[model samples]
Target: MSRLTERLHRMLHADDRLDREMAAEWEEAPAGKPASLPPEEVNPDTPAEQPDWWISVPFRQGRGLRRLLVVLSVLLCVGIITVLVITAQYLPHFGQAGNPANNEVSRRYIENGMEETGAVNIVAGMILDYRAFDTLGESNVLFTAVCAVMLLLRVSADKRRSAAYQLELETDDRMYEPKNDLILRSIARLLIPCILLLGMYIILNGHLSPGGGFSGGAVMGAGLILMLNAYGFRRMERFFTIRLFRAVTVCALSFYALSKAYSFFTGANHLPSVITPGTPGMIFSAGLIPYLNISVGLVVCCTIYSLYTLFRKGDL
Candidate 1:
């Protein structure tokens, strides 16, 4: 029994000594080297660490191209500035008394414009009658700019959040809400009708008064903006929808184009026109000028409103 007990003690001491030697060896191993794990524990499918994106081949190429483009753009701008400076230095001074603008063309327009266009406002006569083609080009430019903006910024309905969801989100966002001040609402309510009436008076009397289509249209647009600010977009949308905007804009442009075309054809051929230029200084005097003013007003009003709506919420 004593010999059996002694053998058991010897076995226990041998196991302890083996464990101590293994732990010492593990502690002494360099951290730079991985521990010698069992073959079955190794993972062969694990991926290696990748370098940063900035050091990749495609990224380096793109960076080089971007730098080249920036340099080229700078050079182009400098060249254009130099050319414009040289050209301007050789040109006539501002508002010179003897400039060609003070010539016979101006005299004829100033003296006979009322008789020719029946518009007491000479500036209105000049823009809508004498240089109607230029006004047409300007309107077309505005339309083109609007289309370009829509193309770039308008998102597809499929990609966008549902209208109901979007509306709820926007309603929660207090930034879009109208002020609830009683004084402001009262003032707006009182002034909005007067503003709209005044705008209409300006537009209708454009041929006789100092105000023309552009100015009257601007005032009308301001009135609309005021209404939106006071009452909010949902209320504004009740009367002015995207469909109404499209229809008005298209019809106004078409009418202006066809009317101007007929006028231009008759004048160029020196043919007597059936339409008579009414009595000067009268509200309904200008032959086609009043109609032109209405058309221009419609175009301008729609443009202003559309721009506001589109920029605010990326839609109209």
Candidate 2:
């Protein structure tokens, strides 16, 4: 009975133990050897491949290292939980006056924002002027996301021309096509211009009013989407293609980065900057803020429209 039990155990665990032994034997064996030789016979001249010594040691010792790792991981989690509990005890009550968030930064931004950045919208001034790089990063992130989606979903021209691909496209079109619905086309004709105008207004008046680049861009993207839906890809492609998307996006990002770099360099060095805040309430006031807002809006608009087109039909 003992012998049978031992044999069953060996059979069940044969893979793990045999693989380890085989690996060890293979590592110690010479190149092109029929069988593993004594270590003394191993060639001194030939470079030996490194073996997984850590795993080999633990496995030979019967899961000791795995159990140890599990214990350590548990201990580490417990330690982290304990530390968090201790830290929480020291935190001030919610909404306390002494809270760290109630700082001078907010006060300064509110008090001297319009004079400093020439933006009537304090939030716009802070984000565009004071935290410009963060906004730039966000724009880059959106661009990156679109690029990733394109990589995954975009169909090549060669594939697009294939019979199988054309059939698939026909199927998709049949499912999603509006079939020249006069009502939708009429509504789109009336609404697209208004939506686009509203988006432009929001972008242009970002510094003077509530709207900014991100919001305006989203509105414009929606207009583009509506237009695409009303008309077909053939009509849309005549104006907006992948080439235009690439050019516009690159130019907007480059202009944004360069302008911000110049501003940062002049300001940091205490040198006179050519860009002035201008009269605060004017449309062209806030120096580079409006321009930056325009750049951001363009990027956001392009990104949104491109993503929609690519996701819907795998091209822009």
Candidate 3:
């Protein structure tokens, strides 16, 4: 009876060991190799072939689906081009004098724009006086974009290293220094003032000349970028700090919004305006256009500088 019990116990232990081995084999089977089969199930005379991995993955199995996708993409592009071409044919021809755009409204604006807005530059008058609201919307858009970028990219003070460390980092002249390039430095020195002067001229004379706030601001931004590249951040920060940037941008945008709101209200109501459109060709002729240009320039300048500074060092 004791010998019979021992045999039964040995059988149970063998079964358990086999079960554990099977479990381990199953766990490893999906990892590119097949589990070992029992000796009784294996047939040595006929070798078992491994199944192709690609058979389970539909994308790798055939080129037909990829070709179909490519063909459909090409067809979609062709259809879009065909639609655009057909639409273009129905559109009015370019530079046609009798086009709907050359209407009485345009004529009135052209004829009386200078007298009404006191701006010699008809384009300036049209943008700032006639379509002042549109320009305001554009300025708001710029401000919003700057705000968004700042929220996304500007690094907080807590995230930055200590001021002493930052000063040490800046003192690494080899990082972005334009060193030993005397010619380049000399040229930059010569051109920076001229660029700044040209930008100011464009902004101030926007009401009397071809350029305006946008163009002049772009030029000024370019000058600032040039100065940064040539002289480095340390020198530029002496005058154009983060505080100055905030102050200038806030003031400029506030003034623009308030003044434009007043102008829009008075013009829409056909009320008498206190602002007198000065002489047509003088420097200060346009009642609010020059001031508006300066405001826009300030906002634009701050935005450009801030963007560059933030992108370079993740702070300003």
Candidate 4:
């Protein structure tokens, strides 16, 4: 019985060992290679290309390199975030406006007999005389703006048809009707010429009087606007057209530039005036101050009027 039991135990142990071996062998067995053409059938004359070393090299290297790249990318991103957090605290400091230098320069110019420029308006003095060069540039800006508006406003009938793929329709004729409000229209018609005259007077007298070109020109523009609003755009358009405004603007600017240049050669700071206004305050006090005012007035008035017309007409 003891021998039989011992034999049975040995048999059980051997069975367990065989089962383990079988399991291990199943796990370790290589997977079947993809079925390939038989070596004998792979014709050498048809070109047996060498295995690409370069292609395999990249794939082999990329596994380790991909891990390296990921680590570097994480480090770089962390560093950038840290730098940004540090920088954000001081960013608002730039928005703080604190500057004394600009005020000092303006103050000095004001105290230095800028009154000799014949501008009662200190701002005007800065505009028409001190930064006269800048004014010239500004006028050119106005000119450019006017030209752009004109181009935009002028829609050719054919272009309109092409855009809509239909016949062009005429705009509402009521938009051009003469103001039948006889009382207002008549009053505006009478008053407009007078206002225009006054504006011209102010502009021409800019060198002599406290008023300068800008104010005078603005006054003139107001008169023009009054006429347009009361009578309609057609009346104003007839008189103060885009072409007319352009010519006037160019001429006015040229006159200003030429006068300044002539003053340089003659060693005179101002134009030759028929009457010089004596001292701080007088009607004929400043020599060419009134005239300069007039020039500025006309330029400003005409430009504003032109822009207004273009805008109202849907040109720009």
Name the candidate that leads on lDDT: 2
Looking at model 1, the pairs that clash are: none
lDDT of 4 by residue, 160-248 (tens): 43423122123455445656578878899889999999888777655445566767788888988888778776566667765677678
**Residues 118-190, candidate 2, lDDT per residue (tens digit)?**
9999889999998999999999999999999998889777667655566666677556755678999999999
**What tens digits encode model 1's per-residue C-alpha lDDT throughout 1-316?**
9976775564435435444555676677786664552233234353221211112222333444767998999999999999999998987777999876678998899999999899999988999999988887877777777677777666446435454435544566556465766777889999989988888888899899888767777788888888877887788889898788778888988999999899888989999886578999988788999998988887787777777777766667
Best by TM-score: 2
Q: How do all the candidates rank in terms of lDDT, highest first?
A: 2, 3, 1, 4
CA error at residue 137 for candidate 3, angstroms: 1.6
For candidate 3, list the clashing residue pairs, or say none.
none
* Cα lDDT over the full model 4: 0.63
- What C-alpha lDDT does candidate 3 achieve relative to the native structure? 0.79
Colliding residue pairs in candidate 2 = none
How many pairs of residues collide in model 4?
18
Per-residue accuracy of model 3 over 1-316 as CA lDDT, tens digit each: 9966775564435445555777788897887677885454334453321121212233332345667998999999999999999999988988899888877988888899999899999999988888877887787788787788888777666435445445546676546655546787788999999999999999999999898888898889889988887777788889998788888888988898899888878878999888779899999788899999888887887788788877777667
Worst 10 residues of 3 by lDDT: 47-56
lDDT of each: 0.76, 0.86, 0.79, 0.63
